[model samples]
Target: MAQPTYALIRFQEVGAAKVQTGLLVGDRVLALGEDINTLIRHWDTTEGQLDALAASVDGLTGLAVSDVEVLAPVEPVQVLQAGANYRKHVIDLAAAHRGPGEDEAEVRAKTAAMMDARAGEGTPYFFIGLPTAIASATDDLVLPAYSNSHDWELELAAVIGKEAFRVSPEEALEHVFGYTMVNDITTREYVFRKDMPEIGTDWYRAKNAPGFLPTGPLLLPAKFFGNPQDVQVTLKLNGKAMQDESTHDMIFGVAKLVSEASQIIPLRPGDLVLTGSPAGNGAHWGRLLKDGDVMEGTITGLGTQLIHCKDEEPTESGQQ
Candidate 1:
């Protein structure tokens, strides 16, 4: 079988003759070119056409990915992310609870018990992240100064293809434009703050730091990555494979995710529902990020994203 292909939007310079990536795809970005700013201003209705344009831009002039800065694909009218979806990560964590030096027999018994608890799992767990928190490919992520439990989650994000509401799961893919790799990095302490256990009121602050959500590499059309369940997703921290799993473990896949969200809340074009991250998150092991740590992650067919954490500094343009 041939590998899946996607339309990658990127930045481009005005006088440059070679094709280039744009600063933003669904949203306006000045560095990407005037076309992006115009698109961002009208993203509400132009998203479908934009995906088509991006996918169809073959044999073009004045744009090469090398020439421009790459940004997140969608400015995102809204964002939804899932929690505890990977089966292996869930299983591994449960095994660890048996305590050190426990007999192998105890490990197997505890694993079975954990699986039973997941039976009849309800609606997919989801929380919103700020659109302003989104960053582009190659952008630097700022570690929160106030918190120390910062972490990373690698997952697949689905982009809405067209306007949709109350659609059946079987017909849901029709509303999908494509897919992208997303890093749903979080501050664990902030996310599960002792003060607020409820997700709705507290999650935004926990997950919405300036560069909490780093996405892109470009949009992989849904037709290319058929059966979202079968795709393989893996992540490595500083050259070690920490997260390796498949979307097959998702308790709720993309089709259902779209259908459920739309039944009550209207899902518009360019809205993003980041399918939940699989287990192996640093937090589960107390392996929080330290300064200068480099992490790389990827989803099959969606491409890869690399993130590095370092000490903060003032920008030349006066950004702190």
Candidate 2:
């Protein structure tokens, strides 16, 4: 059975200038306040207050979810993303970029050993993401005309509820307020910096395009999620399933990720920590995204995100 947890969301009435911080209860939304961020910033008190209001919120509601336009749940001050953190995802990439004569069996064996070693001793590869790139999950996204290899990387992000630094893995999860889904869109060709080989991967250019990180409609409270490791991440392209995997395949679990991240910087309330993506990406299947493609992503318990892709609209300069 699912836990009794309230979803945190932002919504606005048709043509209304104000976006209300809302608690999602069934098909309707109950207005909580004007700023979701403010509520998150004081989640210690907000959590208790929400508990007190749960029974009443369930019975009393303002607007039907269909009557309002849902916005991305929160604007985090920081977006820390993990790369190559999924087991099968890493194996798939290794096989795709393998040297001549590298077979799947051989690649998988080598990858298994390597990943095991990484789990025992290595730290996760973390990167920064531009908050400006985040958009509502259901919005139409324009494929940046700069690259032909736009790919999908569906992820589950941990939303921080408290200020934490240098915390232990055992204590890490205590800082997490909830979880939300995000699709980390990548321009594959730009991943490698040709001009500077030493630079290796240029994540900033390859992954931070506008609307690249399509975020939430619901923020599932941590208590409700219980164990995120069992949560499944799945993405479908044009109604055809492409990526479907679970957090069980994650190299470093959410606790390790959040704890390690805190060692580097202070994770504040409303910040997002993306725990990487699962397998079955475009590179693995040799099918990249193009204009007119649509992606629908869903995670266990979390809601779904529908996105439409189109070519970047021509500007006065005819390019972006």
Candidate 3:
């Protein structure tokens, strides 16, 4: 048996606009940039090409991966997210958005209240946004004018290395390539209040803002983290740390989240599952993103993504 190879990426140079690819084999990283795309085109969407390229690095010369700068590995077509997947986030959301009978019923209806509380707030939540929203690992995020409630959620996103559908949670591990950090940027004021059908309506306008998602540094392979559930996760704005928690706090663990996503759609190679964020999201503080703010997030094995904010015009009130 041979040692498994890994894919790594980085920017071409300081202030470069695009990310380039490389293969991590042993201590050396092989640059695959154009070669990767050429092989993909020739393979016609086959995985064997990637496998071979990953294996062939031993013979490649100056094209070593280590020689290249590291950046986020994949530019995913979609980023799926779980809103309010942390317990503390649930509490914060409840307090921030609480209304009339919501508090009074808390005392008399313990069990019902518990179930009802999560109705609009929790459950295995998920949503998808265009890949174009992703920013390079070192890029700056732009805040649109329409967004008054811009917020950040630190999430561990698993990158799919293979195609899978109707897979069991137990078998979900086989399809994973690796994990990366995602700041599941959001327009809190735009998302519908919990389970409302209106949530779907907001996807187009709310989450699709360019550079809305800041992902990567590199995709740390699944082997890096023996047990995903035990990893610590954190989010920071500017220099102050706001979210400090762990994957153990997730309401739906990685396998379950992957299994559920696979059941609904054909999760193709390179797709991403942003495994939700911890409590202390920006919304809870009544402080949303402002121009010039810097945001950064990290998970146990995955590297960090740091984003500086850029001011921009927001969509008009009825533009969606």
Q: Lowest-scoring 10 consecutive residues by lDDT in candidate 3? A: 35-44
Give the poorly placed runs of model 1, Cα more than 4 Å off: 1-6, 12-60, 96-121, 196-201, 313-320
TM-score of 1: 0.78
Q: Per-residue lDDT of 160-222 in model 1, one digit per residue for the tens?
A: 867678998888888877788889888877655566555334676678888888888776667
Candidate 2 stretches greater than 4 Å from native: 1-3, 58-60, 317-320
Residue 128 lDDT in candidate 3: 84
The TM-scores, one per candidate, come to: 0.78, 0.96, 0.77
Clashing pairs in 3: 9-71, 10-70, 10-71, 29-64, 29-65, 29-66, 30-65, 145-313, 145-314, 146-314
lDDT of each: 0.70, 0.89, 0.70
Residue 152 of model 2, lDDT score: 93
Evaluated against the true structure, the overall lDDT of model 1 is 0.70
**Sorted on TM-score, highest at the top, how do the candidates line up?**
2, 1, 3
For candidate 3, the lDDT comes to: 0.70
Clashing residue pair totals per candidate (backbone < 3 A) = 14, 0, 10
Model 3 TM: 0.77
Model 3 segments more than 4 A misplaced: 1-7, 13-19, 24-29, 33-71, 100-123, 193-201, 313-320
TM-score of 2: 0.96
